[model samples]
Target: MSDLAITLLAGGVGGAKAAEGLAASVYADSTHIIGNIADDDEFHGLWVSPDIDTLIYSLGDQIDRQQGWGRKNESHQVLNELEKLGQETWMTLGDLDLATHIFRTELRKQGVRPSHIVHRLAKRHGITMPILLPTDDVIQTRVKTNLGALSFQEYFVRERCQPTVNAVEYEGASIAKATSESLSQIEKSDVILLAPSNPIVSIGAILAVPGIKDAIEKSNAYVIAVSPLIGGKTIKGPADKMLTSMGKTNDSKGVYECYAGLLNGFVIDDQDSMDATWLETQGVDVLVTPTLMSSTAEKAQLLSKVIEFALAHRNVRAA
Candidate 1:
C-alpha cells in the first residue's frame, strides 16, 4: 500500500468532499490531490484560489460545514470595511479566509510558483497529503453567457449561475503548460480518480491544461471519473444545466461523454444503474453506488468502493 500511489483530479465542494474521503482513507499518505485553479480571481487586490483553499480548509477540518466553503467560525469585518469604502462587496471573502488570500497573493508577488504555494498552504494547515495545482500558469474558466463572457467566479458566485451559458472556455489553456508534479503523479499513480466535480468547469478546466489529459491517456494507471450528476440533475451546482446548455446530455452518459476517451471506468449513483449496466457492456467498467456524500462515512464508503473496483481491474488496458 505504501508504494501504491493514488492521484485525484478535483475542484469545488464536490472535489473537496472527494479529497476528504481519500485523505481519511487508508491510502491517505499515498494520495495526491490536484485541484482546479480556473476559478481563481482577484478581490480587494488579493488573489483567491477558491478550489485550492477549499481543499485545504476541508482537509484541515476548518471548513464552514454549513456553507461548505470558507473557514469555520469566520467573521466578515473585513468585508464590512470594504463595503463601507464603497467596494463591490459581492464575493464575500470572510476575515479568516482573507488571510489565505493575502498569503497567497504575497507569495505570488514574490514570484513563487502557484503549485508550491498550494502545497505550502496545505502543509501549514496541518494537512500532510499533497494538494497540488495542475499548472503554474494562469489558466481561468470563462463562461460565455447572455451576460457576456464572465469569469468562473462571476458566473458561479457573483451571478449565482443564473445567466444562460452560451459556451464555456478555459482561458489560457491552449498554451498553458502542465506542472511536472501533476504529470509525475499521474505517471506514478496506480489509480487516478476524477472527483464528482463540475465536468465543464472544475474537472474540465484541469484537463484543459496542456499535457494533463495526454498524461492521463498515456498513463498505466486505472483512470476513473465519478459523475457529478444524479438522476439527470446536480445535487448542488449547475453542472446538469451547463451540460445541457452546452448541447450535451445531463445524465450519467452525458457526464461520461465529457471524459470520452480518457476513462477506463465511471461511478454513478444507484438511480442510474441502468446507464451503468449499458456502459459496462461497451467495454468500460462501471460502478453503481450512492454517490451523494452527505456524511463523512458516506464519502469514504464511495471512495472505498472506487478503490476496490480499481484494484480488481488494475492495468486492464495494458493486459
Candidate 2:
C-alpha cells in the first residue's frame, strides 16, 4: 500500500478535504494532487489562486477549518484598506493570505511556471506531498448567466452564485497546454481518484484542459470518482444546482454522466443507491458507502475504503 502511487484530480473545499484524508492515510507519502487552475483570477493586481491555495492550506493544516478556506486566525486588514481605497472587496483577502498572492504574483511575473511556483510554496510551508497543477497556461472558468457572462470569482464570490447559470465555459482551455508534470503523474500512478469536487467548475475545468482528459483516458490506472452530491444535494457550493441547470440529473447518476467513460468505478453514499443498477449497466462499478466527511475520522474512514477498493481492482488488473 505504501508503494502505491495515487494521483488525485481535485478542486474546492471538498477536494481539499479529500486530499487531507489521503495525506493522513498510510499512502500519504506516495500521494500526488493535481488541482484545478481555472478558478484563478487577478485580485488587486495580485494573482489569486483560490482552489490551489485551499489545497495547500488544507494539507499544511493552516486552513481556517470553520470556513474551509484561508488562513486560520487571519486578519483582513489588506482587504479593509483596499475597500477604503474604493476597490471592490467582494473577494476577501486576509493579511496573511495576501502574502501568498504577493509571492505567487511575483514569481509568476518572473516567468516561473505555475507548477514550479506551487512546488516552491508547498516546500516553504513544509508540505512534502506533490501538488501538481493541470496546466500552467491561463484557463479561467466563465459562467454564462441570464444577466451576462462573469468570471468564476465574480459568479461565485461577488454575485454569491445567485445568478441563474445558463451555461459554463472554460476560457482558453482549448489553447492551454496541460502541464507535463501532471500528465506524467497520471501515466505513472497506480490509481487515480477524482475528489468529491464540483463536477462542473472544479473537476470539469481540469478535464477541459487540452491533454488532461486524453492523458486520463490513456492511463492504465483505475479511475474512481467519489460523488459530491449526496441525496441529490451538495453539502456546500452550487454543484447540484449547476448540474441541474446543465440539463443533468442532480444525483449520483449525473456525477457518473459527467465523468462518463473516464471512470472505472463510482463511489456514492448509501442514500443514492437507487442509481447503482443504472450505473452498473453503463459498465461502471459502484461502491456504496458513507460519503460524507465532516470530521477527520470520517474522512480517513472513507479513504480507507477507497484505498481497499483500489487495491482489490489493481490486483485483478495485474492478474
Candidate 3:
C-alpha cells in the first residue's frame, strides 16, 4: 500500500468519532484536518471554539463521551456562579476548558491570527495531527430560518434546532479566502476524507470558503466522503432536515449530490446499499459498510475499512 497523506474536513461529534478511528488507523504525522469553526462564539468575554475544542479534547482522550462535547470530568462552578449572578449562561464553560477560551481570546486580542492560535492550542493538548481552519478570517455560518438569520450557535444550540431552516448561508464567504496551509494540504493530499459531520453546518460552511471548492475539484487527490446521513436520517444533528427543507434529497444520495464533481468516492452505510449502487452509476465510486462508531473497537474497524478503501482506490489516483 502507498503511504498516504490524508486531509480530513470535520466538525464536532461524528467528525471527532471518525477522526478518532482514523487517528488510530494511520500515522498521526500523515493526517491533517481543516476543522469547522461554525459554532465558535464568545461567552463571558472569551472566545469559545466548540468544534475545535471537541477535536482537541477527543484527540487527547479527555472528551466527555456522554455529553459528546466539552472536557471529561468538567467542573461547572464558574457557570453556576454566573447563573446565580443572572448572567446570560446559555453556554456552559468548564473550569479547565475555560483556560483554553481565556488563552485563545487573549491571543486574539494580542493580534494572534486564528490559524496560529489553533495550532498553539492543538500543540498544548499534544494533538499530533496538523489541523488548521480554512482561513484566519471570521466566516460565521448563519442559518436563515423562520427566526431570521442567526449565528450557528444561536440557531442550533440556543433554539435547540426548533425553528424551520429555510436557508443557510456563510456570513462572510463572499470575500473569504482559503489559508495557504489549507490550499497546500489539498495540493499535497493523496486521499482527502470528509468525515461524517453535519453536512449543512460543518461541510457546507467549509465549502462556502470561496476558492476551497475549486481547489478540491482540481486536486490530484482521491476525494472520498463518509455520508453523515444513514437510513434516511442523520446519525446526529440537522443534516437530514436541512437537506429536505431546502428541497434537496436528504439521504446519502443527497450528500453525493451536494459534493457533485468534487467527490470521486462516497462511503455510505450498508443500510444505504441501494443508494450506493445508484451513486455508482452517477460516476462516484461507492464503498458500503457499517458506519456506526459506538465504541473504540467498532470505530477502529470502520477506520480500517475506510483506509483499505482509500488505498485500493488510490490506484486510480484522482486527477
Candidate 4:
C-alpha cells in the first residue's frame, strides 16, 4: 500500500539493520525513522551522534557491512593525527566520518534544530526516507557502572562494555521537548515498529524522552517490537547483561515487559518460541520467525513477515 505510513523507533546496529530492511522493502518511501541520540557525545570538540549516523549510513548504502557501523572504505587519518598529537583517540572517528561530526557540530553552534540536521544529513547521504530525531533537545545516556558513572560512549566504545552496568540514566530526557515531526509521524502512522535494538539503552533511551512513549500509547498505529535476543542472548552488544543487571528477565519476554502496554504485537526469533507462547497467553499478538539479519535479503524477509502480521492484526481489529 503506497499510502500506508510506517514509523520505526530504533537505535544502534540492530536499529540500522531494521532501517535498512525497511529501506529495501516496499515501505521505503513511506517509512519514517526516529533514532536514539542518547549515545551522542562530543569528541575532539565535535559533536557525534553515533546511532543516528549509523542509521543514515546503513540506509544510504555507505555503512561498513562487517562492523554494522561507520562508512565503508574508511581511513582513520584524522584519528591517527589526533593520536600523534597526544589527543585521546579511544573514540575512533574515520577521516570521512569526521566530516559528518564536523557539519553537525557547526549546525548545532549555529542553533539549527537537531531534526532538521538529521533530515539534511540523510538527504546528503542520498537517503530519501525521513530520519526524524525523537527530540531536538539535548539528552544523553549515562551508565552507572561498577567503575562509577560513565558516558555511554566511554562505557560502550572505550571500555568495550566490560564494566557491570548498575543502572542507566537518560540525562535531560524528562525535560526534552519532543520534535513535532516525530510526534506527527507517530500520529499518522498505520504501523510503528520498535527495532531489535537494546531495550535498556538504545530503545530505552528513545522512550525515556517524555512525550515519545505517551504519543505511541495514544496513537492508533499498531505498535510492534522485535526482540533483540535470540536464545536468551544478544548476537552483539550488552543488552542481555544489562537486562540481568537491571533485574529484568534475560529473554524475549523481558524485552516485551520493557514496553509493556505500549505494544500490540511482539516479534521474536524462532529460538524464542517459549516467549512467543507466553506473550500470546498475555493476549499479545506474537510473530515467531528467524530474526537474525545476516544480510539484506534476510532483513527484508523478516520485515516482510512483520508487515504481514501487522496487516493481519489490522484486519482482525477492523472485523
The global C-alpha lDDT for each of the candidates, from Candidate 1 onward, is 0.90, 0.91, 0.84, 0.90
lDDT computed for candidate 3? 0.84
Tens-place lDDT per residue, model 2, 167-197, is 9999999899988899999998888999999
Off by over 4 Å in 3: 1-3, 317-319
TM-score, candidate 2, is: 0.97
Number of backbone-clashing residue pairs for each candidate, in the order shown: 0, 0, 0, 0
TM-score of each: 0.97, 0.97, 0.95, 0.98
Decide which is better by TM-score, 1 or 3. Answer: 1
- Quote the lDDT for 96 in model 3: 91
Per-residue lDDT of model 1, residues 178-276, tens digit only: 999999999988999999999889999999999999999888889999999888988788999899889988898889889888888889999888897
Candidate 2 C-alpha error for residue 317, in Å: 4.7
The parts of candidate 2 lying over 4 Å away from their true place are none
